[model samples]
Target: MVSPERHAALQQAWARLLDGYRVTAAAAYPVFDLLASAYSAPDRHYHNLEHLAEMFRVAARLTAITDDPAPVQLAIWFHDAVYDPRAADNEERSAELAATLLGPLGVPRDALDRVGRLIRATAHLTDDRPPPDRDTMILLDADLAILGAAPERYARYAGAIRAEYAWVPEAEYRAGRAAVLKRFLARPRLFWTDLAHQEGDVPARANLTAELAGLRGGEPAA
Candidate 1:
């Protein structure tokens, strides 16, 4: 459960994000409730309120750099709002949910479209194209900030993700996860924005390389 203080903070943040669209608080709480409930799903381990809060923390430092931060903030709130590890359309579903909920709150049609696109972009590794704009880059980088977490935190994040896919056999899970990490390593750049690369690239690469090595029963290179 989200702490009372944290919940209040989230509420304040929601109100501020909504204000950018001139959305009244009266019409926004229900949508906030929907997103909160989704993130609180029992199946969610890493994609819970903690992750949401972390994204906000990352956004707090990044909003100033984004071309338009409001939609980026909104996108962060809804990016993983419909996560289901077994589902291929999680991003699409999350974007759809955001569009449906925010439309009634008076978010402009163009802004809504942007929010939807931002949420969908969190399906990051699934696509090869780079982030299309500064706002998209900020949103994607904020969502991926976890990759550069300290070793202990990164290990926990990996463990949480493994737990989420516990139904898969260890060997299959390792193979699939290794493939995902390798794909990222093969990329010319793992992060789009200069801010993200400066803050996260080295640590993120180290984490991925270490995890991949562990998955393959080998030591990470010196």
Candidate 2:
């Protein structure tokens, strides 16, 4: 759970971004409310507000290390807005809603389009070229940062994710989830940002490897 202090900090971060962009507080509040509604689903566990808050915290930390933050923040809001456990097009749907929402916020059309693209890049299965912008990489990295959390936290996240797909049979869920874990393990770098690469990449890989090994009924890798 995100602490009250952290939630306040996230609100402050959002306010600062809005102030910097000259966006009206009126406009910003509604946008956030709409995003909250969009992401609300009783069946979703890790993809719920807790996940959003964590990504926001990670995005704020990462924004300090990067040049632009507008697109990154926007991406965070829309990345999992349309999470559907049984659907494969959640990314695309979320991206579309992002573009529609941001387009009217006086945000530039180009920027809105870029935000849409960034949201789409969060798809778990994709063979497209790498992310097109720094913001996309930051957004992606923040979403995956949980993979590097302490073992207990990682285990909690795994359980939460499994709960989200509880409707699926255990055997099928195991196969699908194992594939996802392998894809991340196969990556040369789990985190795209230099800071996260140095701080989170190794631990994330180790955590995933150990977790996957345990899932496969073997002793966890040390």
Candidate 3:
């Protein structure tokens, strides 16, 4: 959950970023408001304010190492903006929303395009091209950092995710979740950054793998 203090901190962080950029408070507020409204669905579970805060925290740390921050921040805001579990093209929709919202903010056409591309990048577990610059890599890592969280946190996240799909039948939910878990398990690197790779990836994978195994009526592996 995002504490009031944390939410305030995120707003301050955004304010600071805005100060450094050519944009105005007017433009930034609408972007933030629109993103918040988009994620405020009544059925939302894991994709909510808390998730946004966590990504922003990671993005702050990553900003120090990246040349471009605007595109990265835009990506973070819109990556899960349209998180309908049953939708096959949520990423595309989310990216489209980001482009639509940011285009009128006087954002350079190239920067807006990069943000759209970064939003779409989150849909896949693997990317053939080298990560899209430093900022994109950071946004990508932040979005996926949940996979490497502590066991209990990962378990909670998994449960929340499953709850989001409560519309699905039990058997279908189990199968769908198992497939997603297996896909992550097959990945060579779940965390792309050295910091997250060292601290978060193993525990996240272990937690999910164990949970999936137990869900399948076997003993937990972790």
Per-candidate TM-scores read: 0.92, 0.86, 0.88
lDDT for each residue of candidate 3 in 1-222, tens digit (9 for 90 to 100): 567797667666665665555768876876776666666667877898789888887777767777778778878877899898889899899988877876776667888788888888888645434475676678888987888777777878888887888888777777777888887787777777678778777787787778788769733222
Which portions of model 2 miss their true places by more than 4 Å?
A: 1-12, 124-130, 218-222
Indicate the residue-level lDDT of 120 in model 3: 88
The weakest ten consecutive residues by lDDT in model 3 span 124-133
Which residue pairs in model 3 clash with each other?
none
lDDT of 2 at 26: 79
Q: How large is the C-alpha RMSD of every model relative to the true structure?
A: 2.7, 3.1, 2.7
> lDDT (0-100) at residue 135 of candidate 3?
69
lDDT by residue for model 2 over 4-68, one digit each (tens)? 68556656666666666677877877777776665556776788778988888788788876687
- Please provide, for model 1 over 120-146, each residue's C-alpha lDDT reduced to its tens digit, 9 standing for 90 to 100: 889885445777788887887778898
Candidate 3 TM-score over all chains jointly: 0.88
Best by TM-score: 1
